[model samples]
Target: LGDLAARRFAGGDRAGALAAVEEGLRYGGQAAGHAPEYARWYARGLINQGVWLAWPLSDEVRLPRYPLGPRAGSGPSAMERAAGERALDLTRAAVEVWAALDQRDPVNRRGLAQAKVFLGDRLAELGSAEEAVAWAVDAEGGFRHLLRAAPGAEEAQEAEEALDHIGRQLELRLRFLSFDSLVSLRARGLLPEPLLPQAVVAARIQGVAEPEIAGGLRLDAEQVRTMLEVTPWLAVWRFEVRGPDGLWNVQGHPSHGATEVRNRTAEDIGNELIRGFTASADCPGEGAPWRLLLWWHEEGDPAGARFRAAGGPDTAPEGTADTPS
Candidate 1:
């Protein structure tokens, strides 16, 4: 039924496609609940159902639907949100079942990573920025590990690219204090219109210089500089963990004696800092002491040289990314 639904969706049979998916979900749910032995088969069905539901089969723009911000109604339509939530739940459950049964299955792990990126995209569309970033980070870490393990594998590179795309999308959401602000600026001619809004936003968030931004959008440097000057600047603050197994905290102090301190906490400082950072059985049990910092700045400073240490190790390695919480 899920296969039929996918075919129907591809064939432009909206009614048939939805009906088929509904049937698949109904029967798949029943099988998973009633038959313990057939759990794996049912899990596969759940994955298929999720794929069909979440995949963009129509011309409609799914996630990141325009007019961002709380004022623009509650994020995605009710039906859209419901479908996305269901897809995430089903895919996550399927991944969990596969993980428990076959820890070393590369195929299933890759599929799980893809599903996470897909779910993360949906979550971002629904305006869950922090959660979306976490999911994207997990997928990126998995893909990075796979790429490292199998150098030059096409699938690993593809997965890594997908993770990067999702990361860029999440970064855009984080940079935009309000989506409406971006649109309004563009309308006022302060920001040059770009063909790929996501690309422009992503480059801007990464804080590339005027020339880079201009080349990225095929605009002149002067225009890019003008956009930067007029664009509303929102500081991208991150909480990074260094070392230790104990609880750690990060506090943000905005310049000029700000009363309210914005802070984020990391439960496990060491493991949370770096994705591949792991404890070895042969090594001593003691964990390294990690530092945290707060950074505030406008966009378009020199790459890797933009961030000033509001806090953290004075000799922290240059360009070392703090684990984004």
Candidate 2:
């Protein structure tokens, strides 16, 4: 049944594939009750169904990245979010079953490791980077032990590739500066006006209350809360600033810089900040000495429906851009 579902998925019949896996699990459950050997098959069926539901929504998952690109179609649909959550639950169950089976039969150890890797991938896609890395490390250790136990096994090459992928992902994750750090930078005046919106978003994501965010960023608490409430699809696509030298300091990059701003209310607030800054007598004559670039989109817009706004000396003329610097 698992094989049948796989074939259907490979043939581009995702709905059919999911349906087959669901049916298979029902029969597998009955079989597993009487024949314990069928338990592994049942677990595999669960994983197949989970993968089918989750893989299509992978584009919606946001990871920390430098010069971050726009998300797909304003963000994940309700159906996609539901499917992703269900997938996470199913993969967790499969991992538990595999772990239990591996305890009694060592042969199932390989299955357990594979399931862990799958679980890790799902977690990473769903924005649990730390947990994902933990599972990946555990799975890599298992694969390494397997390689040592059988030096010439066919799976050795696959294990090496998995190890390499895990290492690369871990390195990327390590380079990401936390949102908390970004907020601190803003507090110190290291970040410019354009990034203020992103800083507010970051603060909220980090569990800071609306009032604290308002006080810290010098924004109105009611306005901040209203913006957040109205713009459920708003997100930072990039968070970076470029100094006089023209070199970008991207936020998620190892250099610790940040970009991207979203939402109309947020944009209005950011514009007010830019206007206030530029109007100040202390404002630098070289146009504030930095350029901030941000990409944003409204809900229901196409993926390519992005508008760029630059704050500082390099900004386009007032009427030519989405927002004035």
Which candidate has the top score in TM-score? 2
**In model 2, where do residues sit more than 4 Å from their true spots?**
33-36, 59-74, 104-106, 175-325
- Model 1 bad stretches (over 4 Å): 25-48, 51-62, 66-75, 176-325
Residue 7 of model 1 has an lDDT of 87
RMSD of each: 19.8, 13.8
lDDT of 2 by residue, 133-169 (tens): 5676677777777777764556778777877776665
Error of 2 at 88 (Å): 0.4
lDDT (Cα) of model 2: 0.57
Lowest lDDT sum, 10 consecutive residues, model 2, at 316-325
- lDDT tens digits by residue: candidate 1, 186-210: 4443332332344243345444444
Q: For each candidate in the order shown, give its overall lDDT on alpha carbons.
A: 0.48, 0.57
